[model samples]
Target: MQFKSKKVIYQVFTRLFGNTNTTNTPWGTLEENGVGKFSDFSDKALEEIKGLGVTHIWYTGVPHHALVTDYSKYGISADDPDVVKGRAGSPYAVKDYYNVNPDLANDPGKRLEEFQELIARTHRAGLKLLIDIVPNHVARNYEGASTPEGKRPFGADDDVTLVYKRDNDFYYIPDQAFQVPDIPEEFKPLGGDAHPLSDGYFDENPAKWTGNGSRLAKPNFNDWYETVKINYGVRPDGSYDFDTLPQGIDEEDHNVHYQFWQDKDVPGSWEKFRDIAWYWQEMGVDGFRFDMAEMVPVEFWSYLNSHIKAKNPDALLLAEVYNPSLYRDYIKKGKMDYLYDKVELYDSIKHIMQGHGWTDHIPVVQKGLMDIEHHMLHFLENHDEQRIASPDFAGDAEKGKPAMVVSATISTSPTMVYFGQEVGEPGAERAGFGSPTRTSIFDYIGVPQHQRWVNNKKFDGGQLSEKEMALRDFYQRLLNFTVKSEALMGAYEEIHFYNKEHTPGYDHRLLSYVRWSEREKLVVISNFDAERSYDCDLKIPGHIVQNWALEDGTYSVRDALYGEENVLEIKEGVGHIPVKLEPLQSYIYAVGD
Candidate 1:
């Protein structure tokens, strides 16, 4: 449970990572906008990713999902367009827990074997593997293909007559037939292509509840109508049908949580996911990235995550849980390793990037989450958010430098960077299923900026513009230093407040902090201002001066990331260093004798 090195996670949308197709036609078929296969992650490609100082690679959308492609030759039925999101489908709408997306394999029938090969390749490259697991819902037409021996696929044992049976895998609407959501004017199934199944109908008897918990037979167009919610022993009237965790269990760790559930029986849904996790662990997958983890009960997590850790103590368990109030429960009792820090840090930093918030707000957030900060992972861009260089975001990749530095260095939590974020992809592609601000998760399209680095599967930066190469170099230096810097893994104390009051010319647009261990001391500073640089004297506090056991003398200091050498002068018991911070600049200086 003790974190040693700072871990960086590189998230690559699996379907888009190596696609070289430039035909970005909206609503184009897979033939027009080709998909990246599992085979595409060559040893060279993985080496390029590992060179970013990443410890893990989260292959987004790896599971078998409902899509509009025909795969009858591979024993998979064609999915109805009415319920599929795009030519490629929403990765979250998983249709089979036992298999991977056929679209990612060179041979559809050997899809699982190909993915196993990928897992081995990733580990051989000295990087770990992390894949998505959507526990809250499944594709509307989940197949559960390739079920293991002596096990039933989900809903195979369900009683369709009951609305909420304790052991039923999915909820049912007793007498009503399933109805597809009303199609919005802005979208059409297959982009109005004339397919037989695109007749504006999806057949289902006694429709299950929509993924968003919508009870309507025909959900609204905006609802998560393509997915069906899983029933985890919680009934229609909101009563728990299974055993609950002990009252004080939230205050304990996973070991205790696991012990508590040892003798007790859990809902069937819990068993389903537990088996799935073990299946991947057996395949050597290092961890998982759970989707909408908060929607499912915490007891289930305690049941599953502890089971995972018991098998492999080093397995990483990252999740998407937005409720700050429940953070402790998930981390402590539920045994989760990390959760998304979007609401607090990402939201505040985003405002600063867009010219609204001040750097002063950053410390307040840190102060509040100090107890659980390391358990909260930091990210600048992911599948769910706008790219840092998008017009709707900061509008320039240069503007993200300071924000990225702050997010990465402010905590010991894992740092995540989307595949294209380092090179400033603007997410401007007009992919068929979504808008401009966010990358399309539902369509088959190439990522122009990231594709440049792919360089026709050479996995080289040959096609990058000069500016892009520079940006990527900045990332390389910052990220590479983080994993090796002992101070980053130790203690942290912010000097932003002290400097605001004592240092002349210091203002809310600039912030400073110090990180130290017995062997290393670092001065980290960032300028949040977009248009103005600052010339100021940054002071190291007397307490920190004492912590470092310094005297009235000079110490050689140099920026570890960009090599700005300077001298740190300690007069009496206080330390002062003159610094020049360019607009949106950041510095991480190593203090030495």
Candidate 2:
């Protein structure tokens, strides 16, 4: 039962998911783009997401961030355009950690109640809730107006005059005043639109360090200037102001880490983030996706995550760590349940999909992380990545089919499905801040392809074309089986190497693997070729057949992806199943005795 409950995270950008607006004006006001509300995620919407076999829904951008929108009526302060990334702000620049985003609420004044209702609705749909918890930084103006009684905002207790201190929440420039980054002549805050707040000046005496750790009074335009770095007791000289973990602690479990920190005194910032996480847990949030986890110290994670596990041992602590070398440190010492597998598996698959690399490199990547495979979460698309259908990417959504199958079933790790990924949403809009290949989290813009599936709040794919519907069905079938199949969480062996050496018609464009458990067995193969189709007598070695205890008999084999019936004939000892793979096609054959 341990591996049977495989996790699939369906990440929905809260402000964009239910927004049906078709007018995608660059740097358009929230009214023009029509931001999706917390209420937009109706019960039917949650059920539709749950229907995709998602165990958790990552409601991204839930926390209140520094947006250019005017919410003064709700007692929320307006953010200067010079500081914000886009009309709608970057989710990582959290303005207030204690409050939910007003843009995602039907009534800005009752935003908290609406989010709580969303948490209830999400749980009622038999799915857990996940939200972003950015501990490394906060908006330049961190106003905790909604912080409950007795809870102070960040920097409230900091000695702002000091450059660094054990109790200080932020690193300061001492006497220097903060100046806005020199605006490049080519770029404007609201796509060159005029706003009273876009005057290219921010008034701040004794400027704090930038979010990316830029210590200058005026951070560069390319830096995360909208946000300021949180001081986790890490000094200017790169020394820890807090107690370090015991030696060899990275090899121990979270419980051991938790016990070690029980008698120790942690930094003030550590306590602040722990309290924020506890506050969300009280509101029924089951987990957090820590933003830019690598930027923060691994020791802080060990402290906070261990405390989190103490309260809810099953809590999912997923982190956005991209460095391969830091992967084990973040997972083991940091006590994170999962880390992004972007650098290894994801990059390799994307290269193959873009017709650049051979599938032979996939096994090499997978083999390197066999010990910690379960902690490496797999995903093809996320908010930061370009859409599969974008011209800059593969220029075809169909290419993701085989890649998605291989990503999901390759190991005993969790899988993430970005919203609009299933329906082939090409992020072609000219959003304000960044380039267009990836969906913009900066400006207020509607997701055109995803809106088709939204279909005027119906939450049904009523407006989807046949091809889009077929693509979604492919995801539906594949993900539904993945979440229920114990074999996906079992032992894995790359059979493509075996097939390439032994079987004819098998080439480098094809990848084959086998996964099995006590109850279920799966033979998975995918074709990465964009123009070539493959027809190969897929073979499992004699040792694997003997391991499965297959006798001289014909076994029932069917494609779990398309329900294509086939037979696995065991002659002598080797098991053979004939497979036909079109360009970018994949098959997960369930072998039954």
Q: List the residue pairs that clash in candidate 1.
A: none
TM per candidate comes to 0.98, 0.98
Q: What is the C-alpha RMSD of each candidate to the true structure, in Å?
A: 1.3, 1.1
TM-score of 2: 0.98
Per-candidate clashes, comma-separated: 0, 0
Q: Can you write out model 2's per-residue Cα lDDT over 349-374, one digit (the tens) per residue?
A: 99999999899999999999999999
TM-score of 1: 0.98
lDDT per residue for candidate 1 within 1-593, as digits (tens), equals: 34488999999999999899999999988899989999999999999899988989999999899998889988998899999987799999998899999999999999999999999899999999899999999999998988888877888899989888989988898899888877875588878889989987888888889998988878888999999999999888888888888788878767777788889888888999989999999988999999999998887898999889888989999999999999988898788999999999999999999998988899999889999988999998999999999999999999999998899898888899999998989999999988887888999998998999899999888899999999999999999989888888889999999999999999988879998888889999999888998999999999999989999899999998889899899998999999999898988989989
Query: Which stretches in model 1 have alpha-carbon errors above 4 Å?
Result: 1-3
The residue ranges of model 2 lying beyond 4 angstroms of the native Cα positions read 1-3
- Poorest 10 consecutive residues of model 1 by lDDT? 249-258
Evaluated at residue 283, the lDDT of candidate 1 is 89
Clashing pairs in 2: none
Q: In terms of lDDT, which candidate is strongest?
A: 2
